[model samples]
Target: MATFRREKCTINITGTNRAVRIAGASGGFSDRQRAISSLARLDVDIIVGDWLSECTMTLHGAQKMENEKLRAEGRLMEQPAGLFDPTFIENLSPALPDIARKSIKVAVNAGACDAKLLARTVENEVKRRGLDLKVAYVEGDEVTDVVNRLIKGGEKFTSLMTGKDLKDWEYTPIYAQCYLGGAGIAEALKNGADIVVCGRVADAAPAVGAGMWWHDWNRDKDFDAIAGGLICGHLIECSAYVTGGYFFGFKRLMDGCANLGFPIAELFADGHCAINKEPDTGGKVSIGTVASQLLYEIQGPLYYGSDVTANIEGVVMTEEGNDLGMTAIGGYQAEFHVYICGLDLEAKAEWVEKQIRHSAGDAAKELSCSKFSLNGYCPDNPRNQDVATCDLRIFVQTKNKKLVDKSTLDVPGFNRWCMDNGLQGCPGWTLGNDQRQSEGKIYYEYYVSLLPQSEVQHRVVFPWLGGNTLDVKPCANMKVYPRDQPSYETSNPVNLKSFGPTTRGPMGWVVGGRSGDKASDANVGFISLLTIPKIQYLLDEEYKGGKIERFEIPGIRAVHFLLRDHLDRGFNSTSTYDTLGKNVCEYLRSKWVDIPNKFLARGRF
Candidate 1:
């Protein structure tokens, strides 16, 4: 655990650590409406949800830009509605009485561009329904003006993907929303707010704030417990993800996906918690499902949020499953991942790039970006065929609609162009049969960076206090928190033969994995390195064969991998079917590999 310092100000730690159960009712803007009413009926103290997502940022940002243009031209028709998620109002309308009846507290970041507006709306609804819920909202996430000032001061706000500076960006930024943390949300909840609304807090902030308010956890003194809340928030933030919604082992789901149950976290005051769901709900809670979200969209082992940073390297999950099938449009992309075994890794990766470029011909200029990555490491003296392979991915993004115009192209557009050199690919070359990824579509190149918490005017307002507002202080390290943390990298290889007798099979047959695209890179994560686990055993079993990075968390018996540039430009800009890369783990699971016979005997399935 790491220690974080606070400023000279004192924070009141009033509440004792007691058991608190919170239900995850929504994952994002379009989550099922049934989730709210359904979870509200459960025996939970608080209901938290995540409505903000990366694309929603793009959507709202783009909408703001468009509306500005319309206003300038006098083409604006009044003002735009639903800048915030209207779905929140719709979902909460039916769940309000249940919430009030149970005296359940609620928190959510459903406010997209405007938290005050959404909060007021919720307040009005409460009053209209003759309910007694006190509603408040956290503001100050919209930092476009602050960002502009910083730009003038020479702050680059460089892209995490490319080193391109914000000033050098092609599109004018409509707004720069800094991700606020739980402090503001906690302040509101603690100050008698029954329903807390927020705008642009991190997805996990709702839960973190609820936990902070309930347990009076000091952000600095109780760093580890706060970190536990951060991790817990991450687990159920996406609603049913930790309860088998997107489990890699969906086929093993005892209860089918129909009406899958949302997850509930029984968080203790000290931050230890067990994740469960409503009885007889369509999903199941187990170590496998929980581990998937622990790996989703994380950049590294130390997960940093606006309020606190969580160290997830040693995080663990257990099956205690008292239950649970479980079970996006964008720029078109025609792409494929190729697996090649044996030497000349980079050389062969380059060879594939050249061939694709040659095939792309003049249309290459129309491409927004194209990336070729040689992923996965092969083990020397590999025991199985899969261990000797590397994934050479050809990822391309283009906004030019003409490139995909069927009237002018043959062989169904770019897919054929990328496949033109299939015969000349790397040694022992094998490619996914799917050829739809070659198509390109319009998508925002997802960019993420940090904004100083000190610059955020985090505040909370209570509707009952005649619209009273209170400013919440930023974290102590806000002034000095680095924009970038240490990057996680892997090294020191081991041969597959070290794992004993092997059988040829898919790693998913015995293991569980979860992957998501921050729209898909080679591997999406931040900083970490650890002892190599069996994922390195089955997925990267070859000794020094490929460069696929693998990570281990001994507590949970799990290994994670990072696949660089696997998806061209991710969901917003990709034309691939696996836009969000939710299927990446499943794809890896389906790939045949040499598995240790011993472990296979005790597999999850």
Candidate 2:
């Protein structure tokens, strides 16, 4: 049994749950090897290698289909996705080659298994073996089905309910994943499962489950007893992500990071675990980064893992100066297997493209005029279902809407230069608006999983492999493959324009419909105003003299402005308010008219 010695509080963590963190080397094979080696150093009960991804799966499926097609034509089949590489499973068994030596056990929760393929493999193994090796498989998408089935069947939560007892659990599923909580895994272990396999369980589920078994936890207990295991699992779920991948302030933990060994959960039965990496490791574990993650990455108001809802709200942390900050999580509860899942839908795809263009120095004036006349001469097919009315996208760095509007119109005149021009592919002196892709519509798909009637499948293993091969060489690959692009219906017509890259220089502001607006090339001597928009705005304000200078608001960090240059005021200026108070008041009132004085004063505005 694991135990914790707390100095300030009586912390008692109970339950069969544990977790270990592993880190990879570089990107592909090297990373896998490093991860396996890191896992080897841990004393945990189970090892989970997250290799397969949904995107990877899709790519693999497409590759397999393509390979199958080629093989039919007597052509050498191209390698399917990462299937050709053995590093994925190659690293699995090595993570702890001597686990059996220590009488310790480990299980594989296939990262993202093909449900049909895995089920068939298990069934075949069962047929081949008479060994009493207990095997268990957790479906990722069936927890809801299990809960619903229990409700309908009048089965109490306290009692053990198996999938065999459910009548409606036969729903064929594309991906059925149930995040079996630690209690469930403990029950499985108690029932004698030498090896457990699952599909799409939450990253932390297996570690927590293993910890629970190791600790011999009770099912009806409070959550704190399981919080330590839960936290440990969460830390290692993404492997090195916690150690360094996502840590922005990594310089602080550079010492304990030479070898950057994998993390370990020195878990105590009192719901507290000391998070530390392997000795001579090349990773950093500080309180700041971990706290930041706890605040950001965690999903719910209360952090919920397989067996516990760790209310990190009260998780205490202390900074040991440059050393790691010790974390103490308390006050949590377990929601059991009563997770919720909505109806499933089909997948859809979409893409977008953007383009811009402009003309060169002296020839720009003539080209601008040519484009105007050419628009009337030639036009793209106006009648196309997959297209829409094209418009000139006048992109400017200026926040000035007025300048943007003027530029939008200025682009058409660019065609005038095309007249008597020898340039061959010069858009034929046409005023072409850039074509823009439209938004995609909602797509839906039908799905079925053994949710309500699903029961736990237990005890299945084969002969040749034996229970010993729980750490066997698995045929796994992680290299991503490309898939056939899905055909999308262009319901929303795109802009009717020849969409392509353009070549042009910046446009000068038009003054009273005349070019050469200003030659105000005065250098402000400061790099701050070096941007084109700023220089233009400052020059316009100085020459035109109708500039409005806005002030920052009190108690407000940022403010939105509705600015329009080239207004009726002859000389244009930016919108600037003298008193942030009045402008802010008006702004807030416009948005919320019913806001009362007390609310505004209370900073609830």
Candidate 3:
């Protein structure tokens, strides 16, 4: 509860080889309490907290708008305070004195969309306790007006995921934010600020900014070092993620990992970093743990950031001893996903494709569609056979963004045409989810793409320092490259009849899997409970020439399949049934796969 008197101070560092140890306190709002504890216990120069995710921003924005509406209607007293993460003040209040006493700087993106307001809240809290913590925030990421102006000027504001213009969207976006880099945070620290809050920055921006401030790294001349810091930021950006929290081998670390410690990175001037956690805290930090995190949600090998692109293709992972994990950094056109449902009983996938082609014309030139039959109509019990209607789901893919958008926009017309031909269709011409089917859902998939660093505006606002702002620019030495696609191999011919007596059951019976969206692509990684050869045989016979491509990570006992052009440009803009790719694995699991009786006899399935 102690507080320090306010003092104006400037941070001046004069060391090239000095190393900075920064801790990632919170991954998101849920980790508030634990994150605060890390600041109290860990010996670090700075603590970086990340509380903003894409979903959190949207939800928080909606809540703020709702509160404003209620206020206008006289539903409450004065407007509620703190539009940023609600728990930010609660978590940081108690630790302010300790942070001040220890002379440690704090940088976080807990501000979400309202950095200035969040900064004011933090400033108020500090003053309430008689503390003089200089709080600063970075702005300019809020691009609603910028977007509107661009749209007015006839700029498409094309989606990076779907490559479609936002002009075609039926509804205007609530807000459009650009992902900023770490230069702003670094600038804030340089100008005597103790705490830096930001809005919608790249997840690792804080770490990168802290590195820049600590080392005085030149933005133009230090591309390698900056890239290195960017990598470090990514490693610990999710707190416990680098410390065995979400490792594929979670079971092995379960005993002590329940209270997993947040991650800290000891970053060198050269950009190399070592990740660890507070002493006596739970969770393991090893090669596997770090590698798992490094690969999480990544698209192609090249990891793009607002400041630098880290090539991870040749990154080496090795163990220093028993507990530490190390990695060496190094350095695509993607596809969109279309989900079609509620087909008439007589409707065939080929017919649906023809109709789509006709509606789309040249737009559907290179597009490919894959059909899936939902044999049962009952959402409550998918296995029930007594349902009156079933659904035909089609997944369409192409590199053409306009074609995808047009196909989606033309769904109503397609449905009308189908209903008109119902009499000529099959005997049991029925459809489910009539309303949703009539309004076709299309998603523009996300893929890793690059933009010039010069285009990004990075700036810091010093609220405590009379609201002055400093601008930061991207490195002049940086080079941008297009993302590469994953190379796929054709499935080896397999004679399923050669395998002994088989049981036709859901694929999940023999395989446990996980699926997620990487930009626009859907990555489904599954482990075989049975032998690899048998699983290979099943995949070869079942998934050949499908939109998915199968590959293996030899280090882990798992097979992963990348569903190219899946998820319709990713979660943000995807209108697909499964926007997050969360259902891909479950749906595949529900599909019947012929399993060898030998494995079933062991009861493993």
Candidate 4:
């Protein structure tokens, strides 16, 4: 048996991006013996290879699209090779070193095809080639869907199922690899596979995979190993996320960028890994950046993976220097993963943009307001409101009646109030039809549900790097969603802001003359302040056949209140009485404005 140790590893290799002799602190395998030989040189036990990523799939899609386009244009291309899975397998074949071929375990987390397919392919190859290649299979699509579903729906929902469900879900069309982690791979290792090829496993999976092998961990075993693996995984998950992709103030450090390198996890049996990278790379390692990356895509305090609940709180990264940092992480509670289903629907129709105009109230100046009431003073008898020239709006949307209806409901009544009250031309209201709705407009929305891994089948046919494989074929399944009348509306800020005659009062409370905070309801208490002023104003104007009532800001044009309502009131109160100025400003500032910006330039209305 070969021995494994925790130490830095150096190997003679060519650079993929730059020409330099870079020593790796950890080792992983492509070819079995090559991996073992590298391990021998490094004296380490495990090696990890990153296979699948969304970015990679997107690149593949783009290439496929280009090939089809060219073929259709009569620009024929050469045939493509049938060396997809073969190349990867052949790459690993050299690992049959004299020391111990069986002892060298291999794993593949790249999912270009189904787990069963990859498993069967490798099995047949090993049998035919007479190589005792022990391999483990991890499904990538499964893990991605599991996490994605959990994020969209909570754990309270019973949408997920067990891994055994794959048997029944083998026929689904998978777009991407469903990811699994170390648990299954570890199980395969214990089951005597010298190598594991997974459909869609996570980048963090290798640590968990190796940990599972070393500890014989079950799904519910000591989660510390899993958690340790998670920490290691977090560091390496993005390949360079921890190194410098999202590094804070990264532009300030020279070593911070020019040559972004991938992360390496020098993992230990204790489940910890010293996060390092290729030497001479252009990036720095520090506590702040690593800590930030650890928090990327995090879920609950109880971090859930397909295999276990990684306790994130226990993981800690400390800064050593500009290019050095230390991570101390452990402790985990195991949790079983849930399987989930998702929809894959295409839009039946789409709405495009069109131009049109409709008239409402002629101008913003048509509005007028008094203490007790408001009037638009329009020349035409305006919509039943006591106000004369109150603003009106004509809204429209794409032919979709449903979306248009919803949009109208969402139109803020506050803008109408401002327009009716002649608060138009308020500093920030710039859109000409600002809040106006149009008629005879159409709209279309596009939506697609990302399917779960079990619902999709991936068939990865890898060709030689920079080499052609198969001849391009025209896609018979090209979908083209036709565009028609755009359902968009021009804003009518003037009329939209002046919906109703009366202004809607701000919501708050008022206390009695001597009422203490505990004794009074602040909301209703506010009714008194406006009520008193309204009554005085009405009475002074002489009960002209109508009741002396305080008018709340009109629901239609509440926006003016949003702009000048509080400002004017506080100004009036402060000017009326110095003692009340501070209290009124303080109160309004606290009660209103959710995301307040002291400076006008800092925030938008």
Instruction: Find the candidate with the highest TM-score and give its number.
Output: 1
Kindly report which residue stretches of model 4 are placed more than 4 angstroms away from their true locations once superposed: 1-43, 53-105, 116-133, 138-179, 252-258, 315-605
lDDT for each residue of candidate 4 in 1-605, tens digit (9 for 90 to 100): 00111123433323332111111211122222233234323333454555543333323323444455777897856753221233455544444452144254555564344455555566676667676555445442433344345435632211111112222321222222334446566656665656666654555666667666765544444556556665666555555555665443355455547555545555444555566554555665555345435544332233444444454434421111000000111111111111111111011000000011111222212212112111123345445433332222222212222222222212242233223423322221112333333122221111112232233322222211122122212112222211111111123323323433322222222111110000000111121123333323422432222211111212111110001111121211111122111223123322322121222223221
Per-residue CA lDDT of model 1 for 359-438, tens digit only, reads 87777777665667677887888898878888778766554456633321233556666667878776667777665544
lDDT of 2 at 558: 16
Look at candidate 4 and tell me the lDDT of residue 275: 61
Task: Please report, in order, the local distance difference test score of every candidate based on alpha carbons.
Answer: 0.68, 0.33, 0.62, 0.35
Candidate 2 structure quality by residue, lDDT tens digits, 1-605: 12222112222434443332212222222343666546556554445444433223323333444465678887953533333223544454453334444334444445233432443444444345433334554443223344455546775332011213223332221222333444444445555665455544445555666666766645345355566666666665555544553343445556654455555455555555555545545665555334322332332223444345554434421100000000111111110001111111010000000111233233223221111100011125435322322222221111111122232223232222222132332221222332221111111111111222125332223322443222211112111111111112223433323433322212111000001000011101110102233333434432333222221111212111112121211111111211111122122122211222332342321
**For model 3, how does the per-residue alpha-carbon lDDT over 1-605 read when each residue is reduced to its tens digit?**
00011112112335667578788888778774757655655567999988976556655555555576788899955757566888888888888888888889999998976888889889898999998789999986655555556557776554444445555543445445567788889989989999999987888889989999998988766766777887889878888877877555666677887677777777778787777676666777776566556555555445566766665543422111000000111000122222223434345444544554455455445444423333344345434344544555543443332343444324453344344444444444344443443443432222232223344455788775577778775555545343343544324545667878899887766655556665566666566433334434544433333254454444445555665666654554544567667666566666677888876776542
Candidate maximizing lDDT: 1
Tell me the number of clashing residue pairs for each predicted model: 54, 61, 12, 92
Candidate 2: worst 10 consecutive residues by lDDT? Answer: 510-519
TM-score of each: 0.74, 0.41, 0.64, 0.38
Off by over 4 Å in 2: 1-31, 41-46, 52-87, 115-178, 183-195, 253-259, 314-605
Candidate numbers sorted by lDDT from highest down: 1, 3, 4, 2
User: In angstroms, how far off is 316's CA in candidate 2?
Assistant: 15
